[model samples]
Target: MTVMKSVPEAAYGILLRNQCDSALDEAVEQVRNLGYAVLNSGYSDIELQAISDQFDSARERYVDAYGEAKLRSIDEYHSVRSPLTHGGGVFLNLAMNGNLLSVLKKLIPGKFILNQQNCVINPPQENYNQGAWHRDLPYQHFVSTQPIAINALFCVDDFTSENGATFVLPASHKAEAFPSAAYVRKNAVQLEAEAGSFLLLDCMLFHAGGFNRSQSVRRAVNHVYNIPYFKQQINIPNNMQGADLSPEMKEILGFDYMEPASIADYLLTREAKKY
Candidate 1:
């Protein structure tokens, strides 16, 4: 969201530095100019740094638990890619998926969920060839006229053109249909940024990972935000529901006192049912 158009970009930037909130208008402009904008910001540099540190830690630990080979298919540029591309992940189980949904209920206090089940990814083959190229959640929600997912790709390392940074087809969301590989081959834009820089791409944009021949590792975290009407790639309210939620787990799911009626509801609702 944006703060206000009347607020000078300088003021807005200051506000951003001080956690000044954005108005939807400012957000719209940011989106128009940069394709995406920061919604809410944290405190100091150390605070934001800590968030990335913890996020990276979680990723490495998870990889340790699940062998790199197991998720290799996910990192592929073509083919099945990420199961989340179709809605599945390492957190597919009942207890694990359930606990997560419950806690989102609280932090957001409504029904916003992180849907971490679909968050896993391993990266391309060590050789790092150019990707097949595609879009993120190109599918539209039944209710939305536009592409449903607002994608945030968090850089886990300094992204460079040589090391397979993710690429985006600028303004592809407005395209009526996905382009042929030949078209993407003709013109594709890479999104290169420093580690800690978050690139938000319109989910509909045709995209892929560039080849990475560098010795350094390339890593990233992508979060897809969508409205409730779209079919979720991963089922959030799957096996666990009802009273199965622990209080702490519910807090994480953003669920307070009730089980979500549907997976979509569990993920998109910002206003929880009031007691």
Candidate 2:
């Protein structure tokens, strides 16, 4: 093994001084280097309460529609998949929050799409689908030059050790392969954050939900935003048709990139983009 030594006089003061100038800069830097960052969702207490209530109702609605047995067959029992389909304007607003979007704009560059949004409820003392270590992209083992996707998990309840907050392997996004079992055991970190905070993660990060030891369920809404080339978990534009949507909202929700019905339809869109 080669021994390593540091240079005694290397300069790092200017790098430290210029590192992060604002909250946004800090958040971006943390997510880039550490693979995750916690940010205030910027929703007021009343709004947070509203989101919690809405998520509860939406989860119930989904459970009723799908039935527990069917959902369990797919390993998604208590989770609400695509709550936005029934969550009304409140969910829409959360998806379009300016604070979250500003961070996304810096991280994603030109454009990104809402790939999926779901409400995940970690029942006290029970298993959830998210317990396994996996990337938000799933089944992929490559690192992008830049982030291809991001996960903004909005905490609907306080995430705590007692309640089983998320566990993350720091800097795992920068690795092309999963670390050794011993390394994971030594390095896995559980993040605790208050309600109404967004746990921002690079989609490539290796992470999992911890087992809830508290007496109450812990809930969060997870939104995965990805580059437009990736297919969405649900066809958002189709599901959201007839709902009043701004041009910008429509574009972000992927209205602009839907597959065309025919060659003629494809040509029409291609021609329209020319101007």
Clashing pairs in 2: none
RMSD, one per candidate, in order: 10.0, 4.9
Write candidate 2's Cα lDDT for 196-233 as tens digits. 99999999999999999999999999999998999889
Off by over 4 Å in 1: 1-27, 30-60, 68-130, 138-147, 231-275
Which residue segments of model 2 deviate by more than 4 Å? Answer: 1-19
Residue 134 shift from truth in candidate 2, angstroms: 0.5
Q: Give a tens-digit lDDT track for model 1, residues 1-275.
A: 88756644543333333232434345444444345443322234564465445545555655665656774656533112222222222222221333222222211223333333223222444544336556666454222234345565555466788788777766666665767778776766776777655555556666677777677557655655444444444444443456455565454333442346898877655444441
lDDT score for residue 91 of model 1:
21
